[model samples]
Target: MDLNKKIRVFVVDDSMVFRNFLIKSIGQSPRFEVIGHAINAFDAERQIPQLKPDVVTLDIEMPGMTGPDFLRKFLPKYPVPVILVSSLNLRVFDALEVGAVDFVRKPDVKDEITSKQFVSTLLPKLLIASNSRVRMPRGTVSSAPATTMEARQLQTPTPRTMEHFAGENKIVAIGASTGGTEAILDVVRNFPANMPGVVITQHMPAGFTAMYAERLNKILKMEVREAKNGDKVRQGLMLIAPGGYQMRLVKRGTEYFVSCTIEEKVNGHAPSVDVLFNSVAQNARDQAIGVILTGMGSDGAAGLLRMRKNGAFTIGQDKETCVVYGMPMEAYKIGAVCQQAPLLTIPSIIYRQLGLLTK
Candidate 1:
């Protein structure tokens, strides 16, 4: 936490070559100090308590005790922030749900270009993870994770009525970055299948959003899919902005649709929350609800403010529940949030906004 002290890092991977490469590259950074390296979970478990690194880089696939399993076992004891270094593996999301803070996709092969790309992704992720708080590895306190139906029952009123919501053509715009994956799930899982259209922009890469959308569709009651060039924003459907593309809301008559474009990164992310929020501000005005969840940077602050100024209902995740508390904090500071609540409470707040639920 001291500004003068470099962030301590521990590297864990089964490949000796990859481990050394990480050490050599990460050691060169002025902001980081590679305190230790481990070739497997057992090695990491032995050294991590003694080293107490600010952040740990772990590979998801190893000889034994995979990264998620390691996190499942070790995080309850040590509680150090962890970042997963992986390829196109969905198990990284599993680790994140347990305790891992973030991840960087490994390049296909080790080369100069891939190395540079990996470092570019890893550094900021590490910075965020080093500062992130681990709260009992996320799912431990709950006997089992809440299903979408359970969350819906808890957060909304009975009978699952959409009479008001569908007629009004309301849209919900959500944005988050670092700790967004699970945070978004926590919030949206609470919504009933008949709720108004919802659009999300979580700062993920191109390949991952598709997988994320697929996972969400399977678990959630409503239809959830990655946004395309001209996807309608309608009731009982959630559209996630494609990674590496900027998404904007456009109104056609009384209905709303999304425009996904492969544009330059805004605020350091391609599917920038600002881009989506700003568009929602313009198109939906008072008909929309904007929610900003936990994230690492100030991406959605200005846009949320614009939404509030245009009479949109804006909610922010309170600091106590946030993993990083950066994006929502910025939005709150700028008078953007009409109500600040915990992650699980946001969907009910949305229902209240639409008069769907009294509480």
Candidate 2:
């Protein structure tokens, strides 16, 4: 591979060893190039403006100014994709909430496996972020408003066939890529404990989804956990597809559950949102609701459309609320989405449609 289209990366960490490790790893791959390295956020602040790298790998803990504080000051000014390299701590969540694109666990000095894993995990996100728009200032997240006619024009009748899916054993399936964890958590947290089963594919690496599930379970009214092979899709439970495996629906008679197994990537993702959504569309069809959330690619669009064709109700998170707006936008373009709602409203809309809640 000539690897000519290199993604320019800026490395920031207080540790020289880690910085050099990252530089070497990135250099070994022709797809990425290290443009600059900084020991702390102040140095980063000065150098970033000069380098203007396409992506930045930032350390959560630094001597003078922390990553989040740096982000508080720098993000508003330079809103590009930022991936946090951090230890397992509360700060990771804070970094996530602050709009860090992705995260990787820091590796020790002598651990080649861990270092390789971090490099592999980061490559995909960096590739995806390369095509993304520049970050806007914090608190200015909203985009231009839509015209009344444009809003009205976009609204379509919720398909009547979707009503039949409201019966027992119903499960809602969602899939997304870059910028999806927060999006999924925001939607899932709003559901009451007694809501139907939910399964999600968020394009995360091994070991991350379990932690994400644990985090969501703490805040959500319903149960949230990473899916293991043979896990039952029970009511009030949200199962996230574990990283490094494909999750599909296994139905025997009326009972259905998630089946986790290693499989090739579909649409550039293993355990793809489409794989799960399509399985539900095939097995649960009239008893499933498929949602396509914010992401950088068309991974879930075709599958959500398949769900619609199979008589499942379908929803797409609208553009203004999405971090990337690529996945939902594609689904909407194909007429796959029956209901398009902002992230905040999606939960209520789903609950209302399922008769789980009254308007």
Candidate 3:
């Protein structure tokens, strides 16, 4: 951890070609140094301890010992920040849940344009991973069982109660980055299927958001899918903003829908939280609920403030529960958050704010 020493990195991939490419690309940066590499988890397991690298870039699919398995074994012992480099797949999320810090999609090595694009996306993530906090994997975790909207209605206050607050028109907007994958799942899984429509913007590359949406749909009773250009925003459905694009809320008559389109990066990210929150500020106004979760930077702070100024109810995840407190901290500092809550409490807070519960 010397300030003068460049961050040392260890690369692990099954492909020798990719390992070399990564070493060359990462080594070019004066801030980083490629110390060593291994072909798979076994090789990495043997060499990593001796190298004592600051960061490790890993591959998801390998000849033996998949990335998630490696993480489950390695993190508990060594506790070094690890970044997964792979093609877009659901297993990437599984790895993140197990404890990998972040991920970068594998580029087409034969294509010059894609190779350059890959480096652009990777270098920053490498820097972020190096400084990220590594957490120990837990043995047991509990999640709320998925229930149908009707079943949820039977347990909570009736729709009659929510009708008084114009809850039918309410929309929830959530944004996150860095440690977002697990944090988002924790909040969303606790939601009842009858809750208001939710829109999420989690910083991720293209090709992975679809799988993320698919994964969420399997676990939550509500319909979940990657947002399309004109998908309707409605109760019992959650729209995750597609990666590599920007998603904004638009009103048609009395109904709300999302407009997902390719656009320049806002606040240093595509599918940015700022873009989504600003749209809610302009379109949904007081009918919107804005929640900013864990992340590395201030991407959503300004937009959350705008939402608050526009009379939207805003919440930020408390620092104690956040994996990285950057986004929520920034929002809280600017008076954007009307309330701050722990990760497990956020869903209930949203329901209460919508007048769905007496508590």
Clash-forming residue pairs, model 1 = none
Highest TM-score model number: 1
* lDDT for each residue of candidate 2 in 20-60, tens digit (9 for 90 to 100): 98888877887888999999999999999889888898999
TM-score of each: 0.93, 0.81, 0.89
Whole-model lDDT, candidate 1? 0.88
lDDT per residue (tens digit) for residues 1-359 in model 3:
46677999999999989999999999999889999999999999999999999899999999889999998988877888888999877899888988888899999899999999999988888887887777556552326553554244324332223223547679999999988988898777756677788999999988898999999999987799999999999988999999999999999998999999999999889989999999999999999999999888999999999999999999999886677788999999999999998776777778777776665
Quantify all predictions' global Cα lDDT against the true fold.
Answer: 0.88, 0.80, 0.87
Q: After superposition, how far is residue 85 of candidate 1 from its true place, in Å?
A: 0.6
**Clash number for candidate 3:** 0
Candidate 2 error regions (>4 Å): 1-8, 24-33, 86-90, 105-121, 133-168
- Alpha-carbon shift of residue 12 in model 2 (angstroms): 0.6
lDDT of 1 by residue, 1-359 (tens): 67788999999999888888889889888999999999999999999999889999999999879999999999888899998898898888888888788888886545889789888889878888888977556546556787764465455443346655432478899999888899898887757788889999999998999989998998888899999999999998999999999999998988899999998999999999999999999999988899999998899999999999999999999997788999999999989999998776776778777777644
Superposed on all Cα atoms, model 1 deviates from the true structure by an RMSD in Å of 3.6
